[model samples]
Target: MKRDPDFPLVRNLVITLFATNGHLIDMGNRLVRPAGLTTAWWQVMGALGYAPAPLTVAQIARNMGLTRQGVQRVVDLLAARGYVALEPNPHHQRARLVALTAHGRAALEAAEGAAAAVDQRIIERIGTERLATALAVLGEMRDLILEELAQSATPSNDPTLSIENEE
Candidate 1:
């Protein structure tokens, strides 16, 4: 909490005030745009790509900290655009399942490769040690923030913002 010993209470408050979403939105946009996806679509693709089994919109929302309605919107868009296909949920007859299409899987694979390339380039430029250190710090900070948010009993904060936590 003591970011700087010399800085006083108001300075700490200023830092805490900056613990919001604007910079993250900008970062996510920059990271996803080169792969020809928005933050939302990329997140949906990633969720489907990585899940052990097909997920319902509600299930995806639970995992991704999204609202059911919000995830349903993404599912609808993905399905309409042929990025995901719906099947009957095995766990619930009344519920539907969402999974990636062949095209969607291909797109996600390519996007992941592109993202890796950019990550490597940044690491190379920054030097691996510095990059690793930064990653460690960011990962820890993200976990701490998410844990704090969840402790407040608001686990589902945003849909488009599901990150891996660098674990």
Candidate 2:
């Protein structure tokens, strides 16, 4: 079948995005390793740190755009390691609030300090203006992809509604 000219560009972008994601995750793992945290653990901790208050596993999942089950597993592990504590939620009977322990906060700060040097190196290589532009473009692309996903989830009457096949 004949493909649109833009297909190659989009395909390359998707491949590059995945490759970049893998590299970033690997870097994150290395940076957080000294703090006894994995990339996943750091991500959960970061979400909690950014939140105004302690959040439930489900809330963390939503904030991180991940699944509740996956977030819950990470929370359980963190809680076991004393990095976080689970307290009864007054609003929800079953959904307990997850809060970072003092140890967790300290570890997170250490990890951030360790990561700052690496981040500075990256910024110096890329330049602040270029990095800002890249960030904006990535944010826009993410929003567009999310909108497409939402549209795809809704039932439609047209059979040829798939964006992939659109001209």
The most accurate candidate by lDDT is 2
Instruction: Specify the poorest-scoring 10-residue window by lDDT in model 1.
Output: 158-167
Q: What is the TM-score of each candidate against the true structure?
A: 0.61, 0.81
- In angstroms, what RMSD does candidate 1 have relative to the true structure? 7.3
Q: Which stretches of candidate 2 lie over 4 Å from their true place?
A: 1-4, 154-167
lDDT of 2 at 107: 84
Model 2 poorest ten-residue lDDT run: 158-167
Query: lDDT tens digits, residues 96-162, model 1?
Result: 8898999889878877775787667777899988878967976676687779876765327644345
**How does candidate 2 score on lDDT?**
0.86
